[model samples]
Target: MPRRAGAPEVNAGSMADIAFLLLIFFLVTTTIETDAGLDRMLPPIEPPEEDVIIKQKNIFQVLINKNGQLLADDNIIGLKELRVKAMDFLDNNGDGTCTYCKGKKDAESSDNPTKAIISLKNDRETKYGTYITVQNEIVGAYNDLRNREAQRLYGQDFTDMEATYLNPETPSGVRDELKEKVKRIQDLFPQKFSEAETSTSN
Candidate 1:
């Protein structure tokens, strides 16, 4: 310990060692929390061809503003209604293509689940919670439809099929069967989520 002209200084001899020990304690004892959630593995991205044209009816627009307000299909709607709305749009069966689809054949809505593209646009200031909720709702719509189809085709849940496919210890024969089922289910309800860039003005 030492005292300067107008300041008293405590002993700093073992301060470094104490700090080091504290650091080691935190490193050893502290449990770091890792973010865990659903296994969301996005498919590979394929750049669109220049001449490709998307019909206006096939693109379902979902807009989120800075205030977390949702505008789906050009109509201001609540989060509770988003999933059902999306499901209807996805399974519209307008062209009578999807034999399993039970949705109303709304010609103004999407053509089919395969060609239905969910266009999501959010403002820069949109709340993270709003964004996540919207995402979950949209994804839930697809999952619900796929589950229905899986149940009809394989008498199993699509989520379980996906989990089994992802598991490494699954038997090869069963995995192969599940692979075909999964692929067929996915082809029936291919999730085409197109997230537009955030609005710069927001």
Candidate 2:
């Protein structure tokens, strides 16, 4: 009788460890993306006030459809042109009141920055990206004007002021000074914008 040789068995003693290491490696390598929502400051609650009537000429109406089509002041405009149109509408001193304004002085345009209001409306099915783009264009229009004014007055850009004086690292005294400057700029280019309810139509 001859003794038969047996096959070598697989050593699985470290298999559990290997599997755990693989699981950890996958967990470390996997990246999850997060949605960056609109970076806007929420308005504080206030007591009900009387409805102040705003003139139609002062309101710069902007409409967006689900297809991302922009209707600026009842005229179809591309996204790239929205900023210029908004800037013109805001900076236009139709009444020759704003000395800072350098607009075309159209009688039908805004009388002053304070009176210029942007009325933004979108369709219910409008894409979030499109809405954000439109909002950015409007905001950029304001920023461009503010930055130019800041440069003219303070010899610095508005964004530079924010980065230097508004950051957490700024000193308390310096922050107060910056606040005054920012308030001045706000007075010059007040953001009197309003967002209306989504329209039912496309």
Candidate 3:
């Protein structure tokens, strides 16, 4: 009688090892996505301080309602126009001080970039994406002004100079020069935002 040979036993140890190696490879090489958030520093808490008076012309009010509607200075507006509006408000040179400003020097607009303030107020139920977009537009306007100033004075873009200044490998002496240049540009077009808890109209 011919006895049937038992089937060869397959080893699963190597298969498990391969799977573990694959998992490790993915863990080491896989890129993870993260949500971008606001990079703002909060002011120190002041105890019952007197209200500081900000000139009405210096304040550029922006509001967002629960329905993601944007209002700039109480007028309903689209996101596409927000950057231009912000730039105009910041560079108005109403006081005739910002010689580099290209604005129309509207008497109702901001006195100077140093005094320009964007008063951002949003309803509690406003979409986070809408708020971020608005913030970006405002910051972009400032960056544009700074870049133009840097280009005119230093023959380079302020944003690029700033990126180099922030790099870890930059030399201290070079960083110092960049710092002065950045300060000059910033002095011309400073970025200021006020996130006050003011009521917004729907």
Most TM-score-accurate candidate = 2
Report the backbone clash tally of model 1.
Answer: 0
**Per-residue lDDT of 73-113 in model 2, one digit per residue for the tens?**
89999999999999999999999999998999899989899
RMSD of each: 4.9, 2.6, 3.1
lDDT order of candidates, top first: 2, 1, 3
Task: Report backbone clashes per prediction.
Answer: 0, 0, 0
Residue 68 C-alpha lDDT in model 2: 91
* TM-score of every prediction relative to native: 0.83, 0.84, 0.81
- Candidates in order have lDDT scores of 0.91, 0.91, 0.88
Cα lDDT of model 1 by residue, 68-95, tens digit:
9999988999999999999999999998
Q: Kindly report which residue stretches of model 3 are placed more than 4 angstroms away from their true locations once superposed.
A: 1-26, 47-51, 198-202
lDDT of 1 at 199: 97
Could you tell me the lDDT of residue 40 within candidate 1?
A: 54
Model 3 CA RMSD to the hidden true structure, in angstroms:
3.1
- Give the per-residue Cα lDDT of candidate 3 at 156: 88
